[model samples]
Target: MLNNNLTWKTSPCSHSEWSQSDLVRGSRILYSQQWTLITDSNDHKSIRTVLPPGPCVPVSGEVLSGLSGHQLLEIWDRHGLRKCLNLTALNKHGRVYDDAQFGCLSWSECENKLLYVAEKIKNTSIEKHDGESPCRKPQQDRSVYCEDWGESLTNKSVPVICVVNLQSGSISVLQGVPHDVSPGQALWAPSSQSVFLVGWYHEPFRLGLRFCSNQRLSGDNLSVSCPRLSPDGSTLFYLQGRVFGPHNQCLSLQQVHYLYLLVVFRLLCSGFPSSLIFFVFVVASSAGFYDLPDYGSWKLLTVQKDLMVVCCSSPNTPPTLRVGFLPSAGETVTWQTLQQPVMTFDFHWTVLDVTTPPEEDNTHYSGLDFGAVLVKPSRPPIEAKTPLVVFIHGGPHSQFPAEWNCTTAGLAKLGFAVLMVNYRGSTGFGQDSILSLIGQIGSQDVKDVQTAVRTALQRDIALDPNRLAVIGGSHGGFLSCHLVGQYPEFYRACAARNPVINAATLLGTSDIVDCVGIQYSYDQIPTAEALAAMLEKSPITHAAQIKAPVLLMLGGRDRRVSPHQGLELYKALKSRASPVRLLWFPEDGHSLSRVDTQADCFLNTVLWLHQHL
Candidate 1:
């Protein structure tokens, strides 16, 4: 039975793989356990779970490309649930590409073939003995250098499209794909005659692609992904955007009217459009966050014909899944509650549209409007002013969408009004806002945050300015460090997760060197003036003035912003005899997204805020 009264602590459950048997007339969605198949009962009025073929052991550990401990490509019978094919024997083809940047998992309409992206087979051949044929050798002395996509994608350097015939259980590496291009996000054509995939060309060299999207082939002017063919295979729909600039741009919707003719039509819209399997709809909003204060984020899990499954949440709410019936032509979408969380506490949220100060020089980002999502507890302390925690999102290009965030909601539950600032450079606002922050990172972003905080304080009478605190990660962490350093007396406390302390220092170490270069508007090649400009814009430049109690969260395995960045700030603050704390997660990356690390980080942040503010 579906749990309608699910609590906030209960994280939302999502399914990735969905299969429908052509022979059977029902829908079967497989969980790892292989049970819980939803079927229409009582003549379509009700739904119930039914058993499939057989039970299987959970394929454990981090399944994403770089973090995988073990991975298996298993195909089971849709009707009987009998295990049909397992491609674990094909280890020579390297690991299957599961990283979001370059991963593909698709099944042909016939269900006899499966298309996926996997790493190019590495050379395991030993030096040929005299008159002896070359054989597999685990310990080869030969050394070869390979340039990868860098950062979290260290293991996935060269990816190739592979197909498997389920009946024969034969794997075939597709030929004709360019040697220089890394093929991913592949799907089979309707007739199953051809394959469509995004081929990312790594010509000169491959930079870190995890956090940066400015990487481009020499002549290609646009980047594209997620190509899907219409049911009849006449139209091709995919997302395309300009190659350079912000890490994320507002990707425009494009369609190929005639697949063979290649006649393209760009769908124009005032807002962004989200694509489902067969449907495309505009997610319109003037505010940066999607759906606003009521809904945090609406994630499309999967689309089954007329039924669309979406996950929605907000700062005060936990993620809930909803099944919406796609309206035909003029009809409106009708949503049915699939899974909803039971709220343990009362809280409310509002979207705040803040403007840059009138007197301040707004030369670069003069017209760009940035704002924040303010979340607060329902009940206020009668005698005391409410504390405020300024939450900044990473990406510098990313925005804090109307979505449920554990940290943001947890802070509000603890009686701290959280202000999630969407600064000028954030996406969803358009290309101009994102471009505004090209040459201005620290100063412009920091000032925008400061202005937002001040504006919130001015507007909300109950907010306590003396109890101000700030928290952010990655570039957001950069701003957190800046907020305390530049305006030493502003924030009472701060928490930075994998922050960029010194851009000049990061240039030599961080994986996304292009991100650093682009932020400061410098060329790829470094110069003395570039170094000076990087240092001048860095948060560490003003570290001597930072007086707030700080909590530093450093991920040892982080490649985007090295752990050295946090240690640099830690050492500087400690040398000044300032109050500071450091929490290190050795196994985590830039996200610190591991379950254990997230729990520890959240607890420590709450404790830190309580201790300092």
Candidate 2:
């Protein structure tokens, strides 16, 4: 059923994910961003490429560009669309990685060589004769299972560093990387004689590294990444964070100076705070800039000489590009607009500070404060009371900032107030805040959200208390299920996308099994006592108390929280004769991020909430 009073129309702007390939030389800038548009049902839409105005010139006389897809490694001249070389044999070992985590296509200082990461070829084939090429041999067993980095990196494991000589068109894997470690974020050392990369140890086992940054590495007290060398080749700069505890935390800048046969690392600075979730970057002294009052977020695009390009946006504003002139000494920097936002929405948002009252038994949570971003229409749709939607973010460790979010804004445009809760354990607050949520998942996070909602309602906001609903994914989904179950009468409706229902079952089934242990503050090696503890803390324990209608949207192939988790809850709710529904996407993963799947999920959610509320 459709809402007849509401109008539906396609958006005027296109959605895109920017690649980290920004390059600048003289007055020219080069970058690549990708977006998908379903032009027709036949999928025969022509592809187009857009570049900055002027001839397609490389950074230097000739830029070395590379592309890895469809089992092919291609090198181009960047200008004139000339193909320099194609290496089809290399992918026979393993597919080349082009993602931000483990992928790299870096050129050496001399520009004659390129470095990248790829999966190591499995040695599961039996050679017919001695010294036979592994690629030429037939595989005797295809069932030899290999553990990967988990979640979004399902196909990635054992990433090896590979370098290619452009002049000779020859590729070879570099040696001397520790056998027990998986390498990523590779780059050429300033000397160009050696390589630098971050290595994750397979010592105990590999965990999902996608949303997690504090995974235990081989080195103690030192987790490093994004290695950059100084101009003189005698110093190395990188971002360093703790090697233990919560998955997402703040990182600081550190540097290492090189001498003959000796190297010393010293911290340049520490405790750089950010309001953004899981902030990670490398910075210099003058890299700091004032956060413009009107802009929700600003991203540095590229720099050329004394000028830098930046992109800024907010909840209601699309991205706008600006060029800033770098000032010398103490002079103020000046900025000029290069591209204005193409569209705007009739919505407004504010960051609310939510504080919890003192709990005598749990003094750690007493006076604990968090934040939430509320998005609503500029003008209320009805003089009476408008419906409100409480939106919870997934990562118990993630924070929600006042940045542009299409889904949140779309819900607001539909005349519903949206509240994005950053909960107590969310990142950017400090180390103690993150640790506070461990062993206190269900109780602490749930109380904070309920308190935030109560606080929001007490304000002069025109939201209907009787027409309230809840929606979330992953950990947020877990919270959503907990809310409707424990406080069964508060919410009118609920939606959970790939939520965690039973922590005990998740310990055995989830790829990131460590999450269960860390969140519950238990040992990973399961026992009867541990399992009992997990079951007691799960949302399913309160299933009998749930009266609110639940809409469970799950991905069949989710590697994070298995689809079985959602199915179990569906069965529990259905058996009780509750108004429960489940929508399954077989090809989707934990994120349900495919364009078509996302559209269907949100549309169905709107229909479900509208019908029930």
Return the top candidate by TM-score: 2
Q: Where does candidate 2 clash, by residue pair?
A: none
The lDDT of each candidate is: 0.70, 0.70
Pick by lDDT: which candidate is best? 1
**Tens-digit lDDT string for candidate 2 (1-613):** 0000111122111212232222231133333232222222342221122223232223321233345543444556537543355555444347777666787777788877787888777665555544322332456644555568888898787787777776776677754455567778777665455566677776556677777755655457767666666656676677888775666766778776644322222212221111111111243435436435487777765443444556778888876655554665675555555445657887878888887767612466455688888888767865678788999998778877777887788788778889899988898787678777877878888998998888888773687888889999999999999999989989999999999999889887877644443432224467798788789879999999999999999999898899999999999989989999999999999999876778778899999888988
lDDT tens readout by residue for model 1, 1-613: 1112111111222233322222242223233322233535442322343334254333322222232454455454447543344455556377787777778677777877777888777555554434211111224632445667776887677787777776776777765454566667777655665566676767655667886754553236776665766656777777777675667777787787534442122212211111112221112112112222246577665544444556677777776656544555555554555544667357778889988777654586576788899988788788999999999999989998877777887788788899999998898788878878887888888999999999999999889999999999999999999999989998899999999999888987876654443533224578898899889999999999999999999998888889999999999999999999999999888998766777788899999999988
Error of 1 at 407 (Å): 0.8
Q: Alpha carbon lDDT of residue 42, candidate 2?
A: 43
Output the lDDT of residue 380, model 1. Answer: 70
The list of candidate 2 runs beyond 4 A from truth reads 1-70, 82-84, 90-92, 124-138, 231-233, 260-288, 302-306, 328-330, 360-362, 516-524
Q: Please report the TM-score between candidate 1 and the true structure.
A: 0.81
How close to the true structure is residue 203 of candidate 2, measured as C-alpha lDDT?
A: 51
